[model samples]
Target: MALDNWFQNWHPTFFQQPLHHDPIHNSTGKRLKNPTNLLPIYFSLNLLGSEHKNLKGPSKVDAHFPTEWKSKELPFHNFKDDLPGEEYDYSLPLRLSSQPNEHYSSPHVDSSTFEKSIYTKKHHNTDETYEDHHKLKALEITGPFKTWYRWKTLDFAYPSLLERSKAIAKGDFVVENNLPLGIEVYKDRIFMSMPKWKPGVPVTLAQLPRVPKEESPPLMPYPNWDWHSEKSCDLITSVFRMKTDICGRLWVLDSGKISITTEEAKQHCPPKLLIFDLETDELLDKYIFDNSFVKEDSLYSNIIVDLRQGDCHDAYAYMADVWRFGIVVFRLADHHAWRITDHLFYPDPLAASYQLHHLKFEWMDGIFGMALSPEGDFHEDRILYFHPMSSFREFYVKTSYLRSDGDHDDGDAFKIMGESRGPQGHASSSVMNQDGILFYNLVSRDSIGCWDSRKPYKRENLGVVARSRQTLVFPNDIRLDQDKKQSMWIITNRLPYYLIEGLDISRINFRVMSAYTDEAIKGTICDPNVHNKSTYLEPPIDEDCY
Candidate 1:
């Protein structure tokens, strides 16, 4: 059956609703006449539907309503009053019809029926609001894995008991110390970064099956176990975050430090960037940052790669120095790097104090979150949006200034965009999708926030897509894949609690969740189709001098 015909036959009430009156443009800036038509195609090909039989990976699931669903239940927070505008209808499911031309008798179906038909379920205690029923929930892929691993038994399943005993005695693996930070998705494997913050982190960078049979699978060292040997300084020391570019290569930002959160911390090696070919699982290139660009207190936390016009050789990487308050720019063509510093890179003393999950702590982290605007024919200059972890404000600068070797002494080059995110607007990692929508982690509210780049960055424009106190305690990193679906991958480690008290091994402490970028922002203000009139905030002419 045709995809559109299936939707019309199965659920005619879906299209009977009011269509968006405002003009809507897609990622390519082409106006869409009826966005609802595009919905059926995505549903049939990528999402949960009877026609999604050919879909692969963890995403593939039987669309038929089961007697008892075994999938994890996602608790969604209610935010109907928070978003002001007409909400789009993206809650209906695409089910198979008994016969052609069949349609529902009523256009007004109980909202609960729509909610129950989908994969996610809301918290029982919360009242079912319009936002709660329509907001697309994040699906947990693989998570809450036992941090403490019996390496020989888990990885090999044949190593002698003596070998496992020796590993434990040598302090080679500590379960509580190994926390998953960054996450990236390739073709069939999901790569994660297990930074050496305390101790017992055997492999800093590891991979797992994207669709695992077991709920919590063991982490396998990427490439092979030999690449993570501690005897060699050339191997990965500690990796907090990484990025996979469009050229089929993984860009790893190794912090080169061990026991970072403890007094025994030491610099194991100079911070470096490692590029590995994902197809062959081989190291392509490794570049050590110049000492002049690094500092004694420097900590390389996150990385983002930019490829111009599909040119692999003519690429650039932007690395965030969280502790030193600067951005390190690397050119792939010449393998040269330079550092740019500004007062905006520094942390906000007031925002530094944080309270999450009833745990209080203070961390003065500088320049952490970084995202790039989508490149297009009309876009003359690609903008880079960034913000410090300890600040509620967002800032931006053009790539032209960053790529140049000239001095950036003039403060006008860096401009703060939009108003403050308020007291609870603190965010961790951020990424911009191909549709010009920026998705970020709201660490304080235990939610994921989104803002369309075409709209002004304000509280009214920013919308919360997903929120679950149990699942999104502290979303450490978020990345958008290059697939047609543009899936957004997130890793929540309950970071503040782990750093202050400790994580309860008995409970699920970590999670890897994902949602389709298009579906995630479908009905909220983040959707460019939703129209709202508001005054744009003017950029501050002068910045406060430190």
Candidate 2:
């Protein structure tokens, strides 16, 4: 059955509006028509009728919260309001291009001051109203554990008898110190990375194993899940982040740096980019970033693959060096790379430190998370949305300019998109769907938030998709599952507790969550039906679309 036909046949009330209104497009010019329209639904859903229990994992805490907290441990805080779930529908005008008056002029706000301002505004805005009327409610669906480490056993089994061992001696490992930060799910298996920052490596990159059946028992690295590499030095040195293209190619950015406490020089291996085939687990290509493209303080934490040309090879991959305050652009076809530096990549002084969920989290992260808009009129003309981890504002630049062989000192192409919807808090990652719905992690609120590009980027248009104290403490990464089911996946590591205090191996230390994208932002600004007209930059619709 056709996608639109399926949605209409399954849930007639899904489209609340008539189909006659002219199609509305987003700020980036992607058509946002819903099921009521003749256009294809960018994010069609399967309409899984009922919610299921959380997926199985190492500990129950991975699915639910612990019954009690230790004296030194902090408790979960509530951020939800008793506001009405349903609201009248309203619309806002689209601001496609940057305006002369739309400049980054707001002064930065520190954590304490930012908190006071947020509380004051909440009280002051009681009478204020939102122009957009669509109401949205975030419902929990299910979450998976990308990878978990337990102290009781070197080889994890359903039942165990060993006691906690701290020594790195034969088979006894300190699993808490081995953090698995990067995750990419492809096909039936999930590919993960455990950066060699502290010690022991069963396998830095391997598939997350499922609960073993009676015949099959869970293995340390899992069976036939390790990436094919002849030597330890040839494999990924340290990958804090990774990305998967539409063509089933996994891109891994090896920072080549070790934990400061473990290595005296802080350099364990040379930084490089590795590409692999997800199906065969075969290394396809590799490139050691030129010394000029990497700075002494560089920490390539995140990567964004641009496949505007319809093929992965002719495209460009943008890597954000968090500590270096710069971006490195690499052309896959030519195997050449260059650096781009700007002050915008630096941390915002006011947003450097944040008090979220009753805990203080601070970092000096520069350009970290980034996302690419759908392909523009030309093959290589998409917009690149990016931001530093220590700031609340967002920015973008044209990919055409980024891929050009220009001098690294040039900084004329970047533009400040706007500040985030609320009291400007830190975000770990951001992702945009084909329909132009941009979803991001709200670190301060322990929630997931999103904005529809059809309307102006503001607080009124932005809405929270999901929030959980135990499940979403620190969402380290988020990505669209891209499995035709319209799902978005997220992973949280309770980073503050791990970095500030210490991790509890007995309890759950990480969580992987997934939600139906359409239902996740259903009535908010991101609702495709809210605005479906094309922007000035969008190409003319084919004659048949009308």
Model 2 Cα shift for residue 161 (angstroms):
12
Query: Against the unseen true structure, what C-alpha lDDT does each candidate score?
Result: 0.61, 0.51
Which numbered prediction scores highest in TM-score against the true structure?
A: 1
* Candidate 1 wrong stretches, greater than 4 Å: 1-162, 535-546
lDDT of 1 by residue, 349-393 (tens): 557677775777666677888887666544545678888887777
- Badly placed stretches (over 4 Å) of model 2 are 1-167, 170-172, 209-232, 260-265, 376-380, 408-411, 530-546
C-alpha TM-scores of all predictions: 0.72, 0.65
Report the lDDT tens digits of candidate 2 across residue range 140-180. 22221222221121232212233224224543345565555
Ten residues in a row with the worst lDDT in model 1?
43-52
TM-score of 2: 0.65
The RMSD of every model to the true structure, in order and in angstroms, is 17.8, 20.3
Model 1 global lDDT (CA atoms, 0 to 1): 0.61
TM-score of 1: 0.72
